[model samples]
Target: MKLLIRNLSRATTEAELQAMFESFGAVQSCNLVKDKTTNKSKGFGFVQMVKNGEAKAAMKTLNGKDVDGFKIRVKRAEDKPTEQPLQDAE
Candidate 1:
């Protein structure tokens, strides 16, 4: 299960996020969005849990929770459709 975490604290690290969710269940992966130029946190990230139930539980306990003065929003991630170019007409 993929979880979208938003409004994360700037100082939040991938490891930190993983640890937080580890209590709920096994974490497949945890990634914290980083600024391309500054190489710093973008204040958001995604967490992947191995089980759907665990993901839901984590969301329930984590959503709207404060970390380092920032309130985090956690929810199931929406799948993004693949983009394609328009076909050329004869």
Candidate 2:
């Protein structure tokens, strides 16, 4: 299951997130969005867990919990809309 984590501390690292989520279960992936120019964290990230049950448990227990001085929000990630390829004008 894919989970979205929000309002993370600016100083939080991907390793920290992985470690935190790992307490509940195996984390398949932990990604922290970073700025293209400055390469700084966007204060949010996504975590992919091996199982839905573990993801739910992590979300239920971690939501609104303080981590690295921030009250983090965790939930199932919304499905992104698929983009249609643009047709070139003749």
Candidate 3:
């Protein structure tokens, strides 16, 4: 399951984030969003867990939990809707 983590501290590292979720279960992947120009953390990231149950557990325990002096928000990542191209009027 893919989970979105928000409100993270700028100092938080991807390894730290992975460790946090690893406590719950195996983490498939961990990523921290970064700025293209400065290459700094965007204060948010995504974590993918191997199991849904573990993901749920992590979300339940980590959501609104303070880490690195900031309360983080965790939830299942939603799939973005596909865009439709414009059509000329008849």
lDDT of 3 by residue, 22-43 (tens): 9999999999999999999999
- Lowest summed-lDDT stretch of 10 residues in model 1? 8-17
* Tens digit per residue, CA lDDT, model 2, 1-90: 999999999799999999999999999999999999999999999999999999999999999999978999999999999999999999
Off by over 4 Å in 3: none
Q: How many residue pairs clash in each candidate?
A: 0, 0, 0
- The window of 10 residues in a row where model 3 has the poorest summed lDDT is 79-88
Cα-based lDDT at residue 59, candidate 2: 99
Better of 1 and 3 by lDDT: 3
lDDT by residue (1-90, candidate 1, tens digit) is 999999988888899999999999999999998889999999889999999999999999999998889889999999998988989998
TM-score of 1: 0.91
lDDT of candidates 1 onward, in order: 0.93, 0.97, 0.98
Q: Any residue pairs clashing in model 1, and if so which?
A: none
Which regions of candidate 2 fall more than 4 Å away from where they truly are? 85-90
Candidate 2, position 27, lDDT:
95
